[model samples]
Target: MLEVENLDLHYGQSRILYEVSFQAPKGQITTLIGNNGVGKTSTLKAIAGRHPASAGTITVDGTLVRLTTAFQAANAGIAYVPQGREVFPMMTVEENLETGFACLPKTDHHIPDHIYDLFPVLRDMKARRGGDLSGGQQ
Candidate 1:
């Protein structure tokens, strides 16, 4: 469960968001749609702590977090896959996936089998260079 209320964000003196609010619960797909430069990505960046909110609050699992950094958000179970795939080109497929472990505890470092199920080709090409993969594959 997640909730964002009365969020405001800015870049220097340029304001990007104003009183933005939304909610998402487990087992549902909530989408944020808008025209270009309407603060969709800005709102997400605020929620994920990629961008700081000038005002307002974000609550996840009933805990209020004033997002100020990506590390804080990741520690609160907020995972963000940005619009552009920023996979490590030099790392193997397996190694790239292993990077996700940074957000998890040691007890959960292993890759989930279901992830492989979703991207079966990744399992087969685990040893290959990530840079060589097709854009779509990455």
Candidate 2:
């Protein structure tokens, strides 16, 4: 499970989140719903370690996570997929997949079988440029 408690964030001096807290249990999808500028993206960014939180605690599977950098977060199985789907437009599908290994040690830097097993369609597009995929495919 992912647990975020008493989360706080700021952009310079302006606070964007105030004591935001939530838990996403294992094997379920959690959606954040709010109008624009309501801190929804900020909250996700903090949890994904894309942005630092001024205060709060984040735990994945009962282990406390240090959100100082994206590497730490990704190593801890946290990733941020933006709404716009920021895939490298020119990179081949396989090359783009390798980008996620940026945070992992070289020895552990390979995609697992279940990834292809689950998204079997991707196996056929290994040579396709990331930008060529449809929104859902991407």
Candidate 3:
């Protein structure tokens, strides 16, 4: 399980999040829904360690996580597909997906077959640069 409690965030004294709390259990989908500027992305950023929270507790798999960086969150099994589909524009489709292996240990550093199953088009365009793909294809 992943848990967040009393999360507060600020950008140099301009507060963004306030007392946010939630829980996501394994094998379930948890969606964060809100109007614009309601802290949805901020909350994900905080959990993904892109930004530090002013006050909060984040727990994963019954262990308290001290999220000091985005890599740490990835190591803790937190995968973030940031807004705007931030794929590497300069790299090929295969290269872009290969970037995800950075979070895994060497023994597990290969793309899984299920990924191709999920995005079948990627299999055909593995040699094509990400920038050449349309926004919808991305």
Candidate 4:
């Protein structure tokens, strides 16, 4: 499970989130629904470590996680797919996936079959350049 407790965030002096909190259980899809400028994206940014939370605790599976950088969030098994689909244009789809191995030891670097199972098209387009795929594929 992923938990955000008493999350507070700010952009300069304007407060984006005030004591926001939520829990996302494992193996389930959780979504944030709200009108524009209601801090939905801000809250996601805080959880994804794209922005710092002024005060709060983020925990994954009962372990507290420090969200200081994108890499830190990845280390905590948090994955964030940007809305703009920011994939390396020159790299193949498989190559992009392999980039995540940067934070892992060499022995654990290979992509597992489960990943391909979850998104079979990725397996078929593994050799295709990221920029060549449609937005949904990316």
Candidate 5:
């Protein structure tokens, strides 16, 4: 399970989140919903380690995580794909997939056939620029 408790986040001197708390059990998806600029994205950013929480704690499978950097978060199995799909607009589909290797060991860097199997369109458009694809495809 993933657990967040008493979470707080800030940008510079401005506080963005206050005492946020939630739990996402294993094998299930949890969605965060709120109107724009209501700290929803900030909450996810904190959990994903894209942005550090100023206070509070996060645990994955009962182990405390030090979400000090994006690499640490990725090692902890936390991936934050920001809204607007932060793919490099100039990169091809294959190159975009390669970017996921940043969180993986060198031995695990190759694209798995299963990925293409799961997203056949990606395989067909491997040479296409990310910006050329529809939002869902990206």
Candidate 6:
């Protein structure tokens, strides 16, 4: 289960969230809905450790989580894929996928062919630099 309690977040002195709370039980889908400028993305960012929460406690299962950095969150098994896919400009698609090795065990370093099956264009463009791909391809 994921639980967020009395969450508060701010930018400089501009407060963005206050006492925001929610629960997402395991095996169930949860969605956040809000209009523009309502701190929706901020909430996800805080949970993903992309930004620090001013005050709050995030718990996964029953353990309190202190996400002080994005890498910490990722190591904790939380992934944040920003709206704009941020790929290495100089790396090829194959090389970009290979970078996932950093977050996995050496035994799992090989890229699975299923990924190429799912996105065949990536296989076709594996040698192309990430910066050269069209926006959709990225």
Every candidate's CA RMSD = 2.0, 2.4, 1.9, 2.5, 1.6, 1.9
- Candidate 1: list runs displaced more than 4 Å: 68-71
- Give a tens-digit lDDT track for model 6, residues 7-92: 99999999999999999999998999999899988999999988899998999888889897765786777777775689998999
TM-score of 3: 0.86
Q: What is the TM-score of each candidate against the true structure?
A: 0.85, 0.79, 0.86, 0.79, 0.89, 0.85
Alpha-carbon shift of residue 49 in model 6 (angstroms)? 1.1
Put down candidate 4 lDDT per residue, 65-117, tens digits, no spaces.
87778878888888887757899999999999998887688999899999999
Candidate 5 lDDT (Cα, whole model)?
0.90
Q: After superposition, how far is residue 68 of candidate 6 from its true place, in Å?
A: 3.0
**2 versus 5: better lDDT goes to:** 5
Evaluation by lDDT, superior candidate among 1 and 2: 2
lDDT of 1 at 56: 90
The number of clashing residue pairs in model 6 is 0
Q: Write the per-residue lDDT of candidate 3 for residues 1-138, one digit (tens) a residue.
A: 999999999989799999999999999999999999999999999889989999989899999987877668889988788898788899999999888776778999788999999989999999999999999878
Off by over 4 Å in 5: none
The best candidate by TM-score is 5
lDDT string for model 5 (1-138, tens) is 999999999999999898999999998989888888989988888888878899999999999987777778889988877876888889999998998888889999899999999999999999999999998998
Off by over 4 Å in 2: 26-31
What's the lDDT for candidate 3? 0.89
RMSD of 3: 1.9
TM-score winner between candidates 4 and 6: 6
**Worst lDDT 10-window in candidate 6:** 68-77
Write one digit per residue (lDDT tens) for candidate 2, span 17-134: 9999999999999988999999998998898888899999999999998677777777788878786888999999999989878887889889988888888888999899999999
